[model samples]
Target: MSLSPRFYDLLMKGSFFFVGGLAGSMYATHHHHDNLKILKQDLNILHPPTREFGHAEEKVEVSKDLAVRDVLKYGNPGPIADALARKAYVAAYDRRLRHSAWTAEHLTAASIARPPTTDTSGPVDRGKSKFIEDEDLPIPFRARLADYFKSGYDRGHMVPAADAKSSQEAMDETFLLSNIAPQVGDGFNRHYWAYLEDWCRRLTGNFADVYVFTVPLYLPRLGTDWEMACVIGSPPNVSVVLASKPSSPLTPDVLELSAGAFVLPNAAIPDTAPMESFVMPIEAVEHAAGIQLFSKAVKAAAKPICATTKCELIIRKFDDAQKKPNLRRAVSGLV
Candidate 1:
């Protein structure tokens, strides 16, 4: 109460300094918490929540490797195991079919570019590479080019060579016989199938990422008990039937094994075709390829998007699609 002037001044200054420091701390703490709240909101958008599957309501863990956007778009149907994860994609190879039951790839704008062009320069010497049997197979069934020689079908690729053009090694990996299917060489492989591959590449220009799922379908049809001989090479009728009918339905059996390809753009599709056109039901792919494509949780979300049969693939030349097998030409041709 009876303090000197200097002491009183010093006391007032110290009080002011103390209050200022407390206010500063409070502001910093409040700002920090606000920033954290915003971050949590963004993460929920990016990572979503774990979803349940089936009537069992089992909660499966989302793979740490996949982003939520990828799961939502691609519907990672697990082959129920037996997936061989390689440099570019994952495949479940079926030796009986001499091709992949199905193959899945997540292509990003970042990954598809050679020099990252909107347009790709198809590989220069890719034709020089030959289809070799996948050494990775446990019991090697030689799906040699010679096997298909004069057999009457083109060695169609489950994962087209154009998609693997990101690198030479990636392109070479695609050549393994395990990845090839006997497709109608003239119409399906060279024409419509190739167009689909081109469509997939063009997707990168519009969206940052695109997911592609492909399977060789042996769709059943009428008047073509003949297709069994040509496609499966069994019943001793394959050569005989191909000789007689150069064009027939791509047959699996009386039971339909339709080829299914689903392309899911992570963002909006930039094409004139409606999204339903590219939507392929997981059930169709599963029935045809005999492999589970996505996890149960992924399937539940993707089913609605895939619930359509009107596809964008336009097959103009049905007659030429089924081609005659050239045995002599097999020695020097690339599928």
Candidate 2:
């Protein structure tokens, strides 16, 4: 899928609002419709009144109908979810799933560039960063560090730490639990997934701007009834996927956009597997996820990303060093 710069601007600013609603809707529709009603009532109570207060002498007793109308004059603001803005990316935290429903980042050569040696805060270092619970989230809604401990899954990043290399603080922000989901470590996160993240970063070399949206989707198993279940402690995160749209200036008044959406199973994907095998239509992704990613005008004018650039992965293995530690942690049931 391809998009105009105008469309990209709109998405970067408002995508999270749609994603947050999508996550809340999925959670409510699948597991808690009744709870949603209660949530609406709670939101009504928590939402500040729009009316201005008056002096005691000027105050008047408003009718119940009038009061209700005043409260809803602008329409109901659905269940409130966390809209997180980090140093390098923005994300919508899914309180019910205890992870991000989706994360968005804009990549460029400058944005992902490594800091200079003379920098005061020091160059971005992944080793110095540790996975931590997002304290900003309510205690009950936060994805605890203990949840992934010994869960036989990696604390997979939706927005890769590599994309935040411009600063140490940027990299550290990527470690927040709000941006993580459970993923198979060896073949998926450490290998193939890392390659995909690298590919997104590499797009900066080809296009002036690369916009990426990472979303975790609960796709139904083939030939089986749709079921949504996750273990309490070790939540089974769903199929993780991302859509990338790169736009370059074609002329002073025109831009060229190319896009592609790829869905990868949370399970390990072999290095030999062709990247094209995972290619999916952008509309399919929107339908399955119940969120519109782009406008029809953008979709109509966009070019297929694979046609614009080689849809291939550059193999780089990190499992040799990580395997032992991951196995040890899995055995000890600790992170």
Candidate 3:
């Protein structure tokens, strides 16, 4: 038996109203919530204020009475939103760092490699860099950096490959020119790299978000070519810099701490030109690299080394024993 025309019309009208109401309710719950808006919410800048550069506003406006909701914007913002949010965050913290008693240890590494020009206009457009993509570093240091990243070096990445390998989008992001650096043998690569990746992931889940970038080829020895790499992302909260001394071509001394090294960026972000203030965080970076670049100094007291004849002989012997793995086929540029 078919329903009467009048009854059918009434049923259709009720269903339409119900669907419309549900849609309207959701829209109001998140988008229209006043507290979620930027203007209404309480903004905290962890870093100290910088007299040189003042604060900038987050344009997302919020109302006084609306309720707040925990919303995650992973894919929603895509890359643009991610960039902007990071910029805003950096602007806040950097100002804070300048004001607080917190002192930043500056680091600079110099290498003179002919740059590879990259054309920005087209697929093959990046201009040929004046310096080579890979620097032909001084003999002593070239052997040293190579030794740092030999087969046993493990191809460790400061910006982890796994994080980028999770998907095509992630993988492509990893390939970005800014997020790369060459490292030594697999020992540190396998163990140390994984530790850092896991640590960053943990920080993301704990902190609202994390912005990171890894600089490649920090060949700071004098007489090497000039090379510079910087990322376009928003600044990070914390920064870690790992450094080592090239004692010999085979065996190098990995310092427990290097004062002037790259920033292990878990939080702090870099913006000022290279000449400006330097940034490095000991704790967060310690977590990222899993190696204390420096040994502990208790009560600001420095430890005295005995430098005895026997001890010195043993140290030299160990350095001499370190084997240099051949990469003649892998790297053709080197003789």
RMSD of each: 30.9, 15.1, 27.9
What is the model-wide C-alpha lDDT for candidate 1?
0.43
Model 2, residue pairs in steric clash: 1-259
Query: Which portions of model 1 show Cα errors greater than 4 Å?
Result: 1-83, 115-124, 218-280, 296-335
**Alpha-carbon deviation at 318 in model 2, angstroms:** 4.7
By lDDT, rank the candidates, best first. 2, 1, 3
Give the per-residue lDDT of model 1 (tens digit) for 1-335: 12234322322221100000000133333432342233223223222355322342445886676576666685755433245676677788766655666677777666666644345644434776678878777555446768888865567666767677676778788888877766533323555345456555555554344667665443222222533211232110000000011122564232211223342211111122222333334543343333455555555433232222222332222345477532211110111
Over 4 Å off in model 3, which ranges?
1-155, 172-178, 216-335
> Is 2 or 3 the stronger prediction by TM-score?
2
lDDT of 2 by residue, 273-317 (tens): 555555556665555454567777777777887778776666654
Counted clashes in each candidate structure = 10, 1, 66
Q: How well does each candidate superpose onto the true structure, as a TM-score? A: 0.48, 0.67, 0.24
Residue lDDT tens for model 3, 1-335: 12234322322221100000000133222321221121111111112123222222224575434233234323333221111111011111111111111112211221111124446422221132111111222222221233334322222233443443223333333333222233322212232233333433433332222333332211111122433222222121223322223434565442222222223211111111120122223332332222233443521231111111000100001124476432111111111
Candidate 2 — which residues are off by over 4 angstroms? Answer: 1-78, 221-250, 318-335
Of 2 and 3, the candidate ranking higher by lDDT: 2
**Candidate 3 global lDDT:** 0.24
Per-residue lDDT for 11 in model 1? Answer: 23
Better of 1 and 2 by TM-score: 2
